[model samples]
Target: MSESGASPAKIKKLDPTEEVHETREYDPETQKALEEIDSCQNEIDQLNEKASEEILKVEQKYNKLRKPNFENRSKIIQRIPNFWVTAFVNHPQISAILEEEEEECLHYLTKLDVEEFDDIKSGYRIKFHFDENPYFENEVLTKEFHLGSTGDPASQSTDIKWKEGHNLVERFRQRMQQGEKGGTGRKRPLELRSFFSWFSDHGDPSADEIAEVIKDDMWPNPLQYFLVPDIEVENGEGDDDEEELEDEEVDDNVVVVEEEIEEVDEEGVEEEEEEEAPGEEDGEADE
Candidate 1:
């Protein structure tokens, strides 16, 4: 008997159905909510996989442009020599050449100005031209050497061509930010062509497409912590499935100990009652 004097009965081992009921700790609402949340997450993951694949294609296309032996059908970028200063820059006769001819021979000069070029021996003069400025020319013509990004002595050259249309990172960031701030409320089509379009020109993305990407990247669990309004989470709400997965395993020792405890309690209560019953019989006999 328990301390409250109610007779103890064996606690029936829960059957599969009963076990399911007890184990089903989550209310229906919570379960439904969690299922929905999981579905949305799966959809997002799939979208991410698709987006990543497309990004890889874009990366490959650009990567090929950086290589010399890409397939014949691929876009070819003429492999100009890596050095910034060309043979024209090093040529002995270049000192006497006209400003226009010097650039034409070099083929990579972007800027030319007269003040930089001046009178020297052999009617040669130094000039200030940005396309290939002779920054570190020796005072003597024989010792004159041009310094540039890829030159032997100068260290300022980097391959990042900051041309007029090369602001891709900035433009993508702006588009991503706009998508986050404004709820487009549209389903984006999964189109590879759209990626090509974005690559070619930094333009405003279709609101629907941006929304789809955002949906894939957004997290429901994170939203809960952020306290974002109108966000819903479903399935095993608040119950970490990780723990439930672990608890499904039971230790034989624990079950044995609990059974032993119940048995001991039953024996102790029965012996006490038996002793009390004998005393009550003796009292009646004496009376």
Candidate 2:
């Protein structure tokens, strides 16, 4: 459906000079494949949005603290601003193929460095896999630096020029952590320490190799450990119980002291009345 609520125009028949749109109707197996492709594309969209937002936030924060400079900044601070996830548009060719034949298309958008992007004519690839067989394809798009500036239409590839320093793995890990924390609406607590051990062991062959050779190697866990509220709650509960007990003791003492004072006043009043009675009798006798 179009945004105006009108039915969208269907793609016209393929031209021989243009990219061919596959027109085969899908079998049940093909439908299943298409669904998987849709799912992956949706995940890719979500990752792109999250990575962009994270990068923007880091840049905004840094902009507030220090002027943008290429030097004298710590590596961690420098790295935070590079958290952008690559964005991808599904190959129109793939879409046309799906519409025609109903086959599932499998492809992933990966962030690329300048060198990597240059190698691919921009960082995009369309890979079609059916059963165990795979076919790889490419489409080229032109890029313009400024909006409204017309460039020779000679260069447009749907491929993205991957910006340098954009780390897909780290962005993916951060995204997964967010989902694990609360993004999925399940609100599960994530322990970064456990992830650190698994990630460090599996990926860093250099570190692992060094550690294996050393007899007394103790590697620091890289995952950030945050204090949970349960420990503080337990301590607070103990203090609250003690306070309640003290309040109860103070209330009991207040009541007992009030009763003792009332009894003493009553005894003093009785003695005063008895002395007054004797004085009245002496006055009557004198009269």
Clashes of each: 15, 11
lDDT of 2 by residue, 126-184 (tens): 12111221222322222211112244212222332223443333443666577543122
CA lDDT of every candidate: 0.36, 0.36
**Candidate 1 displacement at residue 233 in angstroms:** 23
lDDT of 1 at 77: 17
Q: How many Å off is the CA of 19 in candidate 1?
A: 76
Q: Model 1 misses residue 238 by how many Å?
A: 17
For model 2, what is the error of residue 245's alpha carbon versus the real structure, in angstroms, after optimal superposition? 0.7
lDDT of 1 by residue, 210-280 (tens): 22222222211112322322232344455567666666545656788899999999999999999999999
Q: Model 2 Cα displacement at 49 (Å)?
A: 19
Which parts of model 2 are misplaced by more than 4 Å?
1-225, 229-237
Q: Name the lDDT of candidate 1.
A: 0.36
